[model samples]
Target: MTAPTLTETLPARETARSWWGDAWLVMTRELTPTLRDPFSVVFGLVQPLVFLGLFGPLLAGSVGATVPGGDVWAWFVPGILVMTTLFGTSTTGANLLFEMQTGAHERLLVTPLARSAQLVGRAGKEMAPVVAQSLLVVLVMLPFGFAPHPLGVLAGLVLLAVFGVGVGSLSYALAIAVRQQDWMFWAVQQTLLFPLLILSGMLLPLETGPRWMQVAADANPLRYVVDAERALFAGDLASATVAWGAVAAALTAALGLVVGVRTLSRSTR
Candidate 1:
């Protein structure tokens, strides 16, 4: 009897297309769960508003008149947007952990879905809500006299979305690697969420902070995000701040995607 021939694998192009399709399906399914949770959506929408309204006025007098082109509340608005995105994205990992515990992740792995597609889809689904939250922050900021250059505002929003997806992916990966839903939930808040917020220049300018803190902020991608937002609001599109911010956001996304997939694969195995 003749030896059996081995089957040839699909080309990379075809593989990528297949993965993309699977990702889309998963993304759609994931969205349904979020949509059904009206309380989640409502809370996500309201919290940012509360933060902006409460804090904006409180600090306006102190930082508003002191900083260059201050309008402290306006400057703080972008930070709130970033904060909203970060919180919204970070919590997504908890759901992923739940799925893993419930055997949903195992089912997904046994299917023909590409690992990357599954990871991207999960992160993307979380991103949609973040984008909505960020936009609502912008609207809330408008009446407070925060005006971004129209085109720059659009660019900043796009960057924020990309950044959120990346950070969220990273958080999901951490959650998976830990494999404890409650622990992941707390860790996301303690490890990733709070550090990024405090170091990111959200509440205050980096220049005004202590030397070591400023250095740390400089190294933080979140700082760049706030810088980009600040530049957009000032109508200074060509500034180095926005350019660096975009670069940092892109790098974070790329690195996070890689780490997330690896973590998910190992966990599944």
Candidate 2:
């Protein structure tokens, strides 16, 4: 039997197709070019990979001694993953800004796809590349003695995507909201980027910081994500860090997409 049409599956009062399918369409549309471009993958990961190679080992012994597992690479991987997502996804909306200026976004807005689908799909497409970044980082670290369990490695990749989706959605929403304001983008991007990394203990342990700094880091969502990643990378699936990170991911994704959908809708109007 043939699959039911989207309209048939919905109540008679509803006319729109399935948001899931629309999302898939959008995701596939964006992901196709990425898949075809080998260099884009390398370009996206160069900074993180460089940090992993050049700067990471200087403190590897010290950081490893500080961590419970005594594995500096494992401790550091989580922060790098979060950093990877933050630095990578922060610019996703720049393309949208260009599209808006050129009236491309207005055209896309008029299409029959659901607004949620469009936003979700773009975020979804980003997942593949983000996962690829994780793999690349891990492989590069392997020769340096980082050996996370295979299942934990898989879990870490999933969390990286979750974190990426939240950040990417916010990037697109902000880009749409601040259309053509190049300075605002740079200002906010620079301000948000390093603070998140520094405050979250991606470079050092939050616990080792001053009392005020540790307290402040506790409030940063990315800290939870990095902590979760550290746990997962260390083969500790039952860690509370994992739960908190997932919660932050869920909340971030929900907030970002809601605002993004609304912004996309207003832009179209």
| Candidate No. with top TM-score | 2
The list of candidate 1 runs beyond 4 A from truth reads: 1-17, 37-39, 180-185
Which runs of model 2 end up more than 4 angstroms from their true locations?
1-16, 61-64
- TM-score for candidate 1, please give it: 0.87
Candidate 1 whole-model C-alpha lDDT, 0 to 1: 0.78
Q: How far is candidate 1 from the true structure (C-alpha RMSD, Å)?
A: 4.5
TM-score each candidate. Answer: 0.87, 0.90
**Local lDDT at 51 for model 2:** 80
The number of clashing residue pairs in each candidate reads: 0, 0
Clashing pairs in 2: none
Q: What TM-score does model 2 achieve against the real structure?
A: 0.90
lDDT of 1 by residue, 101-199 (tens): 788878888988888888888877866787667776677667757777788778878888888878888888877777754575675467666777889
RMSD of each: 4.5, 4.7
Residue 17 local lDDT, model 2 = 59
